[model samples]
Target: MAEGRRVKRYADLIKRVVSEVIEFKLNDPNKGMVTLTRVKVSPDLRIATIYYTVLGDEKQRAKTKEVLNRSRSFIRSEIKPFITSRWLPELRFFYDETMDYAERIDSLLKSIKNDADSEEE
Candidate 1:
């Protein structure tokens, strides 16, 4: 329980700081309406992966991801809040597709319901 709490605390801090850095510092026009979804940090607190979603097509998503990755170092340097004892954990950015998957599932279910209703009529 304590272990989980520690990781969660660090993850929350990292997420908040990274989101702020992206929102205020990042000026790349290619960055779409990005939403910082979640952050996962290693138990050893040596690495962190940030999950996010871009409100656009795959091309735009890819572009935003490229911009984010290019600015990873800047973000790391900007987020020096002394939250860690050893280091501020390596940050890795990943495009979260769970939102897309959920939307796909919802559409499929709606179509299935429509098909069932039509068959009944």
Candidate 2:
């Protein structure tokens, strides 16, 4: 329970810090309104997986990923002050497809509904 709490706390901190870094600190215009969707921390707090989404297509997302990865060290350094660990955790940025998947499912459901209505008519 304690470990869970610790992990949650750290994950929240990492997410907030990284979000700010990406939004305000990074000078890359190619980031394209990147939004941090979630953050997960290892049990020992040595690794943080940051999930994010871009406000564009696959190419923009790919560029965002590349930009973030390139700026990982800078982001980590910026957030180092907020981390209480003896060593900063390894930051890994990943594209979160949850929103995209949800959108796809929604579109499919709407299509199905339309088909059913037409068939009934």
Candidate 3:
């Protein structure tokens, strides 16, 4: 229970700090409206995987991913002051696909509704 709480605390801190860094500190225009979806911290407190979504197509997403991955050290350094841990966890960025899944589901539902309406007509 205590370990869980500690991990949660670290995750939340990492999320907030990383979001701020990406939003204000990183000046790369290629990153394209990057939104950090969530942060997952390893139980051993060694790695923090951050899931993010970009507000563009595949090319833009790829660019953003590349930029983020290249900026890992910078991001980690930015989080250093806020982190209470002795060492910062390894930062890993991954594109979150939840938004795409939700969009597909919504489209299917709308199609089903349209079909039902057409049948009724």
RMSD of each: 1.0, 0.7, 0.9
lDDT per residue for candidate 2 within 1-121, as digits (tens), equals 9889989998999999889988888999888989899999999899999999889888998899899999999998999999998779999999999999999999999999999999999
What total of clashing residue pairs does each candidate reach? 0, 0, 0
The local distance difference test score of each candidate is 0.91, 0.92, 0.94
What stretches of model 1 exceed 4 Å from their correct place? none
Q: How close is every model to the real structure, measured as TM-score?
A: 0.95, 0.97, 0.95
For model 2, the run of ten residues with the poorest summed lDDT: 16-25
Would you list the clashing residue pairs of candidate 3? Answer: none
The TM-score obtained by model 2 is 0.97
Candidate 3, after superposition: displacement of residue 74 in Å? Answer: 1.0
Candidate that would win on TM-score: 2
Write the residue-wise lDDT of candidate 3 on 1-121 in tens digits: 9999999999999999999999999999898999999999999888999999999899999999999999999998998999998778999999999999999999999999999999999
Best by lDDT: 3
Residue 58, model 3, lDDT: 99
Over 25-75, each residue of candidate 1 has an lDDT whose tens digit, in order, gives 998899889889999999999899999998889899989989999999989
Candidate 3 weakest lDDT stretch, 10 residues = 79-88
Q: Which stretches of candidate 3 lie over 4 Å from their true place?
A: none
